[model samples]
Target chain A: MLSSTVTSLTVLLIVVFLFKEGVGVFDKTAMEEGFVIAINKNNPVDKLSSEQIKNIYDQKIISWEEVGGKKDSIFLFRVDDISNFYTDEQIGENFEMLPYRLSSLVDSFPGVIAFFPEKYLDKNFKGKKLEADKVTLAEFFGGEEWFPTAHPSAQLGVKPLILGTLWVSLGAILLALPLALAAAIYMSEIAKERVRRIMKPLIELLAGIPSVVYGFFGLVVIVPLIQSTFGVAVGETGLAGSIILGIMALPTIITISEDAMRNTPRAMKEASLALGASKWQTIYRVVIPHSISGISAGAILGIGRAIGETMAVLMVTGNAAVIPHGILEPMRTIPATIAAELGEAPNGGLHYKALFALGCVLFIITLFLNLTVEFISNRKKAHKH
Target chain B: MYQIDENKVTRKKKRNQKFVFFLFGAMGYFVVALLVLILTFIIYKGASAISWDFITKMPEEGMTKGGIFPAIIGTLCLVAGSMLFAFPIGVLAAIYMNEYVKDGFIKKFIKQMTNNLAGIPSIVFGLFGMSLFVNKLGFGDSILAGSLTLGLLALPVVIRTTEEALKAVDNTFRQASIGLGASKWQTTRRVVLPIAFPNIITGLILSVGRVSGETAPILFTVAAYFLPKLPTSIFDQAMALPYHLYVISTSGTNIEESRPIAYGTALVLVIIVLFTNLLANGLRKYFSKKVKMN
Candidate 1:
């Protein structure tokens, strides 16, 4: 009983830990520690929205007049750009004179917006600091950018990641459904007993292959194939992810749907045949209609796998954080994001917490899918009884 | 007119049959063919990299020129370690659910939880393992941490399969043992368990295959990119095969040069996973045949 209870409690444990670490992100500021966005002290611009700030950094806004400031070209500054102004000696060894130089520099350029560590700004320093907002749940969810390590403020928006996951998963199901359904039909009705025996184990073997191996295979074969076929510069597009995921999902879909198809009564098929229906007509019209529930359950379970699939999609999907405009464009999934980013994120930091939050999103999605599968399977059981 | 109509019907039937052949037979065979293609491709490309020396020596020179002995050992250790943690707990859990619990809400809940656990993605397991084991418990990316995480991942598979196996044993056998003056435990130990043992073994083997191939769960909890010597303790971080492959293929320093080694490692992993699957399937078939004969 203890073992059973513990096994059962793992689900709850996962949710608790994920949320415990995840929910901390919203309370922290969006900017990296000890850094702020500062503009020229004489400039009249009082505040910038996160969106406007992202736009400016992205270079969508060129002039101060674009955001209610005076008509002048805006100058962006990050500390790395220090070399553009000062010589190596003037910057000092280890940048010891950096604070004075930075302060004086900000004082001189009236239109410059500087992003630097707070230590660089002395008490008498020029330039007014912009109050970087705390990471809000709204911006985290609906925000478009995903620059977790951005200097002025890390854009922790999940919109692109979420949409990318959806697109890849959607594409996988579409590609897998027809082929899996057909494979199910063949295994159930078309294959002779001997052929079915061989095919079944091979399919199971396919399922047994590791996901990383699939990713490697995708990298070597599918990615290159997509690149050459579509004439894209690089081939790690969402389409490549979809193809690999589609193949990975096949065994699950085929197994479930085949079981359901096999359970269709022999009597019904004979009856349909007696009515002068061809073999195809009988199986298609009778067997398919009977097992539709199981087929959908399979598709949904496949979708669950596609959504949560990490290493393969991560390796093949180019890991671009942008929201994909098309399947040919590279995209990133939530699981891939967590997998790629969590390794470098310091323990309990905002970046770490954000990754855990991504985990929470993944957990909820799979839970819903699991529940749906259960609902369908339970209803199917009910029908049988 | 009647003769012409008969001819048209024959053509239509032929077309229908051809469609079925293409739709079902062709598509099914295509999936199988795809699997064959992958296996052959990996084998063909990775063949040159495999040798006794490659299998047993230490890696050198940024992982470009040496053997994968440490990684192979690491993967095996992880597999063995995780099974040690997962197997007993999983079997006991399955037994508790199958032989002890009466059918009702608790049983349903347990079943639901098992399915939910199975559906939880591998990366999520990595996150949880890193949180609870690596940081909170201070196991700190050790084999112990990786094993426990993998053990958790394997637990659901073991329980579900063992439950099914236990369910397969005839209830009459248990009742007969009890009628013969055996205690409940005695009945289960002697009568129900013996009949169910082979199927349970099959399940364990299958889960082993599963645990060995997983990359996501081990990525954070235990994987080291370039460990030179073998780990002498469970707490020592070690290089794992799947993560090794991931690193070299995508993120390693000398990716282009290490391609052959990557393929070689992938070949070994595939062999291990596929061998276990076949072993489990063979055992299952053999046992079923023996049972029928008896």
Candidate 2:
């Protein structure tokens, strides 16, 4: 009971933490509460929208003419630029000289835009404090791209990642399901007792192999193989990821489906064989139909494994956050995105919250898969009783 | 006409049978072939890289050369740390469920939750670990946080396996002890537990394999990208074998030069997992034999 409580409590705590952090992205104060953007007092751009500012910082708007200013290039600055702009001594021992130094720096550049804490905004400063807009929830979810660290504004649209995860998982399921079904059927029905005994342990051993090792194998073998065979310049494609994930999911699918198939009543098989049906017909007509629930359970478990897998897919799936047009193209997955980005994302920042949101999505997906497996297996049990 | 139809039917049956046989046989062969190919390829690429110094010394020259001693020790620490937390709680939970609890809602809920826990992806655990332990609880990136995450990962496995072991302990033993005037606690402590000991150890071995090989859960929580020295404390960040393999293979500065080291790391990891699995199998066989003798 204590252990079980610990298990459930862990799950509860994880969900709570993820949602709490994830939903923080929707809080306007979380991003804009303490920060203010300042521009040169002589700058023609009186007011700018958050989108325009994001673009300006991203270097997407190179010339001031793009944002209705003079046709001069824009210069970006941040408070942390200590080398070229201000030395620690010049900024005072406790940074008391920061406001003066920053205001002066802003006055010097006609096309300068800077971001700093609102407390540093001097009343007589020579810079215009632009009215910063709140990052809307719509911009995060409905946005097309996911450049979270883009200058001016972080692009937090998860559309491409969501689609890429689906595509890669679909490709994996498509590749693994048929092969796993074949192997499961063969092991349960066709293989001799001795072969079955030997094969079962070996298949379980496949699950024991570290996912990182699989990723290593994918990097060394499958990536190069795909590159050479397909004549692609780069081998890290969704196809390579799918193939490795399919191999990884095979053990799960085979074990569960085989167990389901073995549970078919002996009388049914004997009856089918006694009615002059061939062994193949008995397996397909009787054993498969009887074990359909188990097979579905296996497939669901396999899907769960493939979708949640990180390192293997991350290593193979070219980490490009683009909507892939085909299986052979480079793509990124949600889990991969989190694993790669979370290290760099500053704690309590928008990017960090966004990554946690991605985790929430991943958690929901696997939870759904788990529930489906349980439902299918339970229904099977109910029927048996 | 009847004879001709019968002959045609038999021929068609024979053809179908042959096709079915080949299809299934080929699939079974494919599974075995893939395993053999992976093992042989890894061995072929990595065996020469393993040397006495390589096993005993710390990584040198930006991890492009020398041994993986720190990583090996780090993995050992993670395994021991996780087992320290997961072992007793899991065993006790299994005992409560198998020996004490009857058919009830609580038991069902526990079982359901455990199944759900097992199905969660290891990477999600990594995220949880980073947030809950590393940030929220302020353990930072330490062995304690990483092992706690891995302990959560292995909890369901331990619970289920120990439950199975306990279930396999015959009811007659409990009843016989009770008939000898032993109380429930005494009977369980003296009789049921000893009988279940070997199987419980098997479960522990399996969880050890799981903890040692996991990369994702440790990646964010405890694993350091280039800490070359052994961790003096659980609070200190450490390099781990699986994460080392990940680093060298995917993002190393001299990926081309470090390929051999990557293969060596993978080889050592596989051997460790395989050894633990063999140990579990050996214990199961030995215990089953002893049980049969009694």
Reference interface contacts recovered per candidate? 0.80, 0.73
Query: What lDDT tens digits, residue by residue, belong to model 1 across residues A44-135?
Result: 99887667787788888989999999998989998889999999899899888888888888889988988888877767777788877767
C-alpha lDDT values of all predictions: 0.90, 0.87
Relative to the true structure, candidate 2 reaches a TM of 0.89
Per-residue C-alpha lDDT of model 2 across residues B163-185, encoded as one tens digit per residue: 99888888999999999999988
Per-model TM-score versus the true fold: 0.92, 0.89
Q: Candidate 1: misplaced stretches above 4 Å?
A: A38-47, A57-59, A62-114, A120-129, B1-11
Instruction: Give me the runs in candidate 2 sitting further than 4 Å from their true place.
Output: A28-137, B1-4
Best prediction by TM-score: 1
TM-score of chain B of each: 0.95, 0.96
Per residue, candidate 2 scores C-alpha lDDT tens digits across A1-385 of: 6766887788788889888988777764223457778888777887665557777766788887888988888887877774487778998988788888888988899888888887877767998888655556767667678888775556777888988988898899999898889888999999899999998899888888898999999999999999999999899999999998988998999999999999999999999999988899899999999999999999999999999999999999899998779989999999999989988988888888888888988999999999998998889889889
